[model samples]
Target chain A: MELYLIIILVLMILGSIYSLNASDLLSAVISYGIVGFGLVIAFLLLQAPDLAIVQVVVEVATLIIMIAAIKNTQSKIPKMEFKPKIAIYYAITLIAALVFILIFDRATGCLSQFGADTMRMAQPYIDGAQHTKSANLVTGVVFDYRAYDTLGEATVLFTAVIGVLTILRIKGKKEK
Target chain B: MIIYILCFILFLVGLYGVVSKRNLIKIIIGIAIMEYSINLFFIMIGYIEGGTAPIITKGFEHSKFVDPLPQAMILTSIVIGLATTALLLAVAIRLYQKYGTFDINKIKDLKG
Candidate 1:
């Protein structure tokens, strides 16, 4: 399983790099789907079937929307302007990434190794979940244990839809 | 732990795209990539080597369950990511309609 995950993770990185460097917008979006689908698989491998399902569904919708967006405007990516500023930006990003990883590695030294969750907070969920009587613990957690979180999620989705409609509106101002 | 570093590298790839890309759609793709990495990291964090799914069944009620808290949190994050992506695309389309191009470099007047 680890071998398979390593291969998938490497492929996902390749896909991300290709999407960023692709000249064609449609193909770039397609490669982005590769990253997303790879993610769905990773979720499944990690024993999070619920996440895999949600991710797969969302990935398809996102790909379709992105493809539609590119179709509406242009499919050809504009040639990147070569500039000294861009080189500096690259240097800065690379340095920042290195610094970040170093700090993160040092900071997480006290962290437990993978697959050994301390269950500091999750133990209660695991113990109390049986009372909820939901076979699927994830569903129980989402619906019963964290109802307010679900409500917030719904509100966010509603707000985003409204925002999209407003932004795409044909008319924003009244006629004078 | 090494896998976690790899995941963070994926995130760096996304960050690089957002910082360097001139196209709006590419930036959105980068943002999506970043979101995926974060979600994957969360799920990976909650993973147990020998644990089964968190579902409590008839006989497996006493079995080990992977952390359910992160799964629930990531569930919401995924939906929110979709909304974020949609809103971003709509904005990109609107920007195209108004400017007649997807290149941010051409939209110079709005920069100031």
Candidate 2:
């Protein structure tokens, strides 16, 4: 199982690198889809089927949006000259990665054991699922314990849709 | 332990793309990649070995289940990511309309 996970993770990383460095926008988007699919597998292996479903749906939506954006635009980025600025960018990236890894290592200390009840807050939900009358504990927690947060997320989606519509709205006067 | 480290490395790759790439759409893709890595990491943190899905069934004994909190949190995050990605792409489209190019280097009229 661990070997399968490592293989998936490696594939995801490779897909990410390929997408980032791809010469064409379409190929990059396709590679990104590969990365997204790998993540779905990881979620499934982690026993989070709900997350896997959500991820796959969102991944498809994101890919469609990106393909639409790229359809009419230039699909190629011109080659950039290697300069001091590019070297500085690389230096910054290295420093940032190192600092992030150090802080993360110190903060987490150790990875929580697999199949362990790591979150105290999750206990109540697990214990209360029967009383909540929901077959799915995740759904119960999302709609019952944290319904307010779900409401906020809905509002955010609403606002974003409206914003997109307004932004993409065409002017009749300009058309005339 | 190693999984988390690899996830973080993926995040750094996206960060590098955002910092080094000169194209607006590519930058947006990088941001999306960073979002994916973060979401994956969160889901991984909640995983329990030998755990089943967090669903109950009739006449079945339940032993262990994956943590629900991170799953819920990630669900919300994924939705929010979709919204933000849509907005970013809309903005990218508008920028292309106004500037007639996706290259960030050429669209520098608002320099301070």
Candidate 3:
């Protein structure tokens, strides 16, 4: 299982790198899809089928939205000229990323090991899920224990849809 | 674990794309990639060895289940990601309509 997870992680990393470096927007988007699928597999391997389902659906929708946006525009990225200053910027970013990673590693070193049954906060929810009469523990947590947060999430999605409509709608009056 | 480190590297790659890329759509894709990496990391944190899915069935007796809190949280995050991606695409399309090009450098009318 660990080996499978490692392989999936490597594939995801490769997909991200390819998407970032692709010369055309379409190829980049395709590679991004690869990364998304890799993530779905990883979620399954981690025993989070609920997340896998949601992620797969969301990824498909995101890809469709992106493709629609790109269909009417230029899809090719203009070639970039390499500059000495750009190299310096890359070096700086690399050093900063390394330092950030080291700090994160050190900070999380005291946490419980992977797949260890040491999550105290979740124990209550797991034990009480039966009383909630929900077959899926995740559903119980999302809809019962944390229903208010879900309501807020629904509100956020509604607001985003309204904002998108307002931004993309064509105005009747043209100033030109 | 190595998984966590790899996830962070994926995030950094996405950050590089967002910072260095001049195209608006590519930047959106980078943001999406970063979002995926974070979601994956959260799910990984909740994994338990020898654990089954959090769904309870009638016939099976299971003592161990993966943490469901992160799964629920990630579900909400994924939906939010979809909404944000849709909104960003709408904005990108609008930008294209106004500027006639997707290159950020050339679409600098507001530059002082």
Candidate 4:
């Protein structure tokens, strides 16, 4: 199982690297889908079918929306040439970021090994779930024990809808 | 350890794209990548080797299950991520419509 996870993670990393470097915007977005869908497989392997289902559906919808967005945008701007200095700057930043994450990971060093359950906080959520009378623990956790958190998520989604509608309006305020 | 490190590297890859790329679409893609890395990391943390899903059935009422809290939190986070990505893409489209180009450097007039 761990091997399968490692393989999927490798594929995701490669897909992301390629997506980031790809010259074509469409191909880049398509490659980004690889990372998203790989995550779905990972979720399944980890025994989270609920997440896998949600992830797959959301991934497809997101892909459609992004593809539609790119359709309207093409051949407009002169291709920006990379100045040698910016490339060098990016290289430096990349290396610096790499070093930073490594050092940061090492310094924290708090995360346990994969699949090791050292949880001290989730016991009550699990042991106390019988009172919720839900067969599915995750759903019970989301919609019952933490209903307010779910409500907050709903509010964020609502806000996002309003913002998108505002931005995509046919006209932004009447002429001044 | 390697897995965690690799995940962080994936995160840095996204960060690199977000910070270094000049194209608006690429930046959005970068943000999406960053979000992917994070969601994966969170899900991975709750994994328990050989554990079943946290659904109780008639036959297996006492089966060990992976942590449900993170799963629940991540479920919401996933929706939140989708919302954010949609909002960002919408904003991207609006910017392109106004500027006629996806290049940030070229769209400098909106700097105020």
Candidate 5:
């Protein structure tokens, strides 16, 4: 399964590169659409069904918005040519990111090795908590150990809504 | 695992697009790619080898089930991603209306 996913990832990367190089707007859009769908499948294989579903939905919405934008703004911007040797730049950045992640994952694995410890500590609490009955450990974590965080998250969303309203200035406008 | 490395590569590809692509739509796609990569990473963390789903059935035992916590976390994250994508799309649309173009390179009014 992992090997298959790796192959798919490689193919997706190649497809993205091809899309990047394709001069046609429609092909680029199609490539992005394919990538979006591929990501949804990858998310499910990685055990994130909820994310997969939501991502697919959001991606469809984004594709629609992008198509609309492209229809309105149809021409490429004529500016300094993209002659920064993108291949070299991407290769270097990819290596740097991979090294960083590897070092961090390895170093964190060495330091304290507290993942199991944290789980062990939380185990009794988790088992004892009535909230676990909700069938969502994340919700338990959210509303129990970190109820304050949940409140803050809710506040952030509320603030975002207000911000959107302020920006729209649609005081009497019908809700969409 | 190889899966993880590939996911990281996918993430790098997306990040590269985000940094190098000047088109607004491409940048948005890049961001969406990054979002999916993270979601994939989170889910991978909870995967158990040969482990069954957490659903409890009449004949099922609890010992073989994989951890359910990450699944729940992913559920919340997915919803958050939805909200983010919606907000960003709204912003992108407004940007198009304001500037009449999706070329970030041409947007010079906000430059410092």
Candidate 6:
């Protein structure tokens, strides 16, 4: 029953997104909304209600911000349209989707055993960890086993913000 | 199976939008779509068939409990997504204020 519902939901999402190709701004907006909502639903169905909540909230903010930006930047500028060969694109995409589905199914089946084994082996670590109070294995992995990587990632984000602000500040000074 | 294929298709369409669209906002939409697709993919990864909710109860045994780890991982990812989208929108707003247009073709003042 759940599988059938999932299939229907998937179809609805695909149909809505495919409709985004229409050369209409309203269609684009509606399709994007559907896509975003579908993603949140997909997350919920996949046992990640936390992600679903986050995704929905973030997506709403993103769409609103983008729409505001789009409205502000309103102009009579011509929209760029793709002129790809329709048949070729469709055929390629269909084939690619099929191949991707097949690969995912096969990989999932193969990885299931490995995942169980890994989980069993890690049982001891889970049992022994003092940080189990955090109630998050990925968090434990992030801040413990790969603290260096997390630190580097933080550094990168900090650097990016500083760089962008510096550039914008220079531009502001020049404009004044 | 079909759900997996549909997700891939959605991703491809978003990719096409990002690659082919010249409007900055459209490109941003494409990027947002891609982020969503990945988020969905990650969620799907942690699901167990016929899995019960991960709530603990006294003296109750459940053989089919969903893994809650991916949900936790994605919680972080979603916040990151929010930060990224906010930053990107700010950049877009700044770009519009400076350039007076969202067309990538027209916003080529820095092309020296």
Specify the highest-lDDT model's number: 1
lDDT of 4 by residue, A1-176 (tens): 98888899899989988887787888888999999999999999989999999999889988988888889677333455779888888788868987897796886488788899766877787787789988899999999999999999999999999999988989658776
Native contact fraction per model: 0.82, 0.73, 0.86, 0.74, 0.26, 0.29
Q: Write the per-residue lDDT of candidate 3 for residues A1-176, one digit (tens) a residue.
A: 98898898899889888888889888888899999999999998998888888888998998898888888667878677899998999899989999989988998898787777866778898888778989899999999999999999999999999999999888746778
Q: 2 or 3, which is superior by DockQ?
A: 3
Q: What lDDT tens digits, residue by residue, belong to model 3 across residues B1-112?
A: 8778888888888888899888888899899989999998888888889989999897644668888898999899999999998999899998898888777887886445
Backbone clash total for model 4 is: 0
Name the lDDT value of residue A81 in candidate 3: 87
* Top-DockQ structure, candidate number: 3
**lDDT per model vs. reference:** 0.88, 0.85, 0.88, 0.86, 0.63, 0.60
TM-score of each: 0.93, 0.92, 0.95, 0.92, 0.72, 0.70
Which runs in model 2 stand beyond 4 Å of their true positions? A83-92, A114-119, A172-176, B110-112
| Candidate 5 backbone collisions, by pair | none
Superposed by TM-score, candidate 1 places the C-alpha of residue B80 at a distance from the truth, in angstroms, of 0.6
**Can you write out model 5's per-residue Cα lDDT over A12-86, one digit (the tens) per residue?**
777676665556556677787777788777666654455566678867876775676567556564444656696
By DockQ rank, best first, the candidates go 3, 1, 4, 2, 5, 6
Candidate 5 segments whose C-alpha is farther than 4 A from its true place? A18-29, A75-132, A135-176, B109-112
| Model 3: docking quality category | high
Q: Which stretches of candidate 1 lie over 4 Å from their true place?
A: A81-92, B110-112
lDDT of 5: 0.63
Individual DockQ of the candidates?
A: 0.82, 0.73, 0.84, 0.78, 0.39, 0.37
Higher-TM-score candidate among 4 and 6? 4
Error of 1 at A109 (Å): 2.2
In angstroms, how far off is B15's CA in candidate 6?
1.3
Candidate 6 residue-pair clash tally:
0
Question: Any runs in candidate 3 off by more than 4 Å, and if so which?
Answer: A173-176, B109-112
| Best by the TM-score measure | 3
| Candidate numbers, best lDDT first, in rank order | 1, 3, 4, 2, 5, 6
lDDT of 6 by residue, A97-170 (tens): 67876776777564453113223433443443355543444455456755676676566557656654654454
CAPRI tier for the interface of model 1: high
